[model samples]
Target: MADRIVVAGVPVDTRHWIGGRRVASVETFTDHSPVDGQPIGEIARGGPAEAVAAVAAARDAFPAWAATPRAERARILHAIADGVDKRVEELAIVETTDNGALLRSHRRGVMPRVAHNFRFFADWLLRLDHDDFETRGHTNHVSWDPAGPCVLITPWNAPLMLATWKVAPALAAGNTVVLKPAEWSPLTASLLADIAAEAGLPAGVLNVVQGYGAEVGDALTSHPDVRRISFTGSVPTARRIAASAAANLTPLSLELGGKSPLLVFADADLELAVELAVEQYDNAGQVCLAGTRLLVEESVASEFTRRFVEKAAALTQGDPRDEGTDIGPNIHPRQLEKIDGFVQRALGAGARAVIGGRRKGGQYYEPTLLTHVA
Candidate 1:
């Protein structure tokens, strides 16, 4: 396989990682960066065939990986963490270019968490215990075992961070993984495949199939041989995956989207409340857990909203790679349009945006605050 290469100022290995090796597809899709709507790289467009192959590879590697000692697994995981630390900058840059998240946020927070995920799980694995209980002069012991091959379908918002959140625990518990990253931001996940290989992990233990969810994702979740499935995305898509996995009775863990709200009382600190409110715009309001809806006490609602709009309007919206930028472009034009639709609908109903309600340009949407949303 060729060494990692840079395209359009982004480092990428735009191929499917199957059986611990980089494999290219006959057909490829160009990934355009949301930063400036420029081509970042051409990624292998894997379909059902690639998904099946990846699952088979994971199934093949499962026995040896499951039987491997817990200490050995911990060591390998630590090595993977080290690899992530070494290439944190490159990974951050690739994610920023691919997804238009703030580069500083990725460098300082998200990338570090990726490495930390591995290390945390590695340590946790060593600390895990089997418990025994005595009842009526009899003793019963309980233990856990590897569940077999797992399929991890991660979102694009925070690709490596979320992928590793699932990957670390699954691998640490001795189950091989077949990760299907969201198509919008797959570059960092590809980088992680390389890091795992270099960390001395065995072949077929980790596989990546990159493509649209309908093709690769459906193949993975619906596969008969899959033992477990973990997905983080929308409720509608989760429903689809659940239906697919039902055929095999596969165990599934899902983390879906919600309208998280932040509440502030009349006596609360106004400035701090305003700060937290503005933080909802972090990652250009793409954060799944962000408090998108704010509920303030009517007594202080006017003051809090005033400060929030002032701060939000002053936020820097520009290229993600720029250090001065606070908010980056939306992940894709379609996502931008969806956000606009929501804002417009709110306006049509009766609400008004005190700060912003329009797209700045290209993929950048203004930091908007809507009042009279009740």
Candidate 2:
């Protein structure tokens, strides 16, 4: 890993904001730096005890927060957005180091998009109003109200930004949160918790736990006090969380992965088409919105395939921290292997490798493109 980030600032001894700052039981987990497959930091993983405690804290904080006016909540959201802007570079660095994303890339590409989400949702919340009318011969006003305490389970792909997506909206709607970031990159979540604390958020209005989903996620999902869950990840894992939430009749917002379609027409700019296909593969095609399954008009398939292969061949695969590279190593060795297998299986099934078709190292795979891929 070429980027050396400060990790000693993370809280490794205890979880905060429960029982008036009482300590909780802690176990250690080695958070790997995906750029080099090394232990970047030691995060103390919280278990059932800590999970329940965080839930209880958020639940305890919900009533007061929910009672707060919408405009007041919006004011706090503005503060959070300003807080995010103040530490954009730091968050970018921590996010890149924790998840193999290029900090500069995120700052240039993703953070701006995230800031737009916050502003859009913030405006949306303020504009939401009640409809006062007489319907069915009755007088009533239907108004939007805050959903109570919530738990957000976010993946590591865009840890800080995605958490902000949930946090900004939830806070704007006057709901308190308990976030469980993937154990791979829990440090960013802790950093957000610190920011929220400094922003003068009331104790327990926002809490974060570091741990595996099986123990911590299950505990938070099933805790009688939790009002809702919003999760993002693999469809299979989401199904499991859905099942767990069902037992409690808990409201769950699901955004499982989507297989996006990229269509290249006959008259399309070959250079632009190829550029798009290659660029979409950044993050090594790990994003839920990655335009993975391309469907080109058969008339231009051959030309498009050739151009796509040539462009993909130009992508440099190495450490994200390295400034010259356009693509980086996969987030984990297993993910690297999984993508390799996908290539191989496609090859075995007669999917022609238009460009790269081999692995470089344990964690670095080639910038590959395939055609006749099913």
After superposing candidate 1 on the true structure, give the runs of residues whose Cα lies further than 4 Å from its correct spot. Answer: 1-5, 8-11
What TM-score does prediction 1 earn?
Answer: 0.97
The list of candidate 2 runs beyond 4 A from truth reads 1-5, 8-24
Clashes of each: 0, 0
lDDT of each: 0.92, 0.76
Quality of model 2 by C-alpha lDDT: 0.76
Which lDDT value does model 1 have at 69?
Answer: 98
The deviation in Å at residue 23 for candidate 2 is 5.1
lDDT of 2 by residue, 229-294 (tens): 999888887988888888889999988878878888888887888787777877766788888888
lDDT of 1 by residue, 96-121 (tens): 88899999998999999999999999
Report the number of the highest-TM-score candidate.
Answer: 1
lDDT score, candidate 1: 0.92
